[model samples]
Target: MLSGRFRLLRREEPERANAAIGLDIEVFDAWTGQARAAGTLSGGEGFCAALALALGLSETVQAHAGARRIDTLLIDEGFGSLDEEALEMAMEVLAGLEAGNRLVGVISHVAELKARIPARLEVTPGLRGSTARFVIA
Candidate 1:
């Protein structure tokens, strides 16, 4: 996603050896120029990779087949791990999806996101219960 390459890994092991052996992805680190398993990625890197893959796959499926495009995407709380620049890039990607008439819902406690995203439903904890409020910019 971040100038990195995604290599799809097919099932390599025998079915009896590992039933869970399914498709996996190896992500190339832009800095190191080496591919590593997706499981080895940092939280922020993982989030970016996942977002990019989902968006790419959605576009590919809709363009190739007569399949319905994905209408919505919901991502929970992975923004905190990203740096300022990475966060900016991630927001730009999501914004592009929104521009395509797709509903992209992001749930995060990151303060920067509050400034970037306009309409939001925020939840604050209290003694009785969490207070929820709608904030629109």
Candidate 2:
């Protein structure tokens, strides 16, 4: 879903990347279509690429390994970095993964994201402490 440019390559040399932080990957600009280092991506773009990778790997596991079923995916805090279009795409991907009794949980402080989510647990921070509430919309 990432403009068809999401690629996870297994390169062992540090010369290929700045840091071998694990999960070697590269992505192309959505508009420019030019290949670029995944590390060089803007915060939002990097988040998108990482999410796509996670989902892709999950699908691979589900496909090749019949003994396991990935039924839960939880994402925390990257929503605010995404632009409207990217956010929409990310949300759509997350929603699609919810098929087959899977539970997708997103934890974000973005108001736009909160508004779009129907069923959510709202956590409020007050002077004294914090309070949490759940909505089953």
Poorly placed runs, candidate 1 (over 4 Å): 4-19, 61-65
After TM-score superposition, the amount by which residue 59's alpha carbon in candidate 2 deviates from its true location, in angstroms, is: 1.7
TM-score of each: 0.80, 0.82
lDDT of 1: 0.79
Model 2, runs deviating above 4 Å? 16-21, 28-34, 64-66
Top candidate on TM-score is 2
What is the Cα-based lDDT of residue 102 in candidate 2?
A: 85
lDDT of 2 by residue, 41-132 (tens): 78887898789878878989989998598999999999889998889999888887775578999999998877778999999999999999
- Model 1 TM-score, 2 decimals: 0.80
For candidate 2, report its TM-score. 0.82
Per-residue lDDT of 9 in model 1: 46
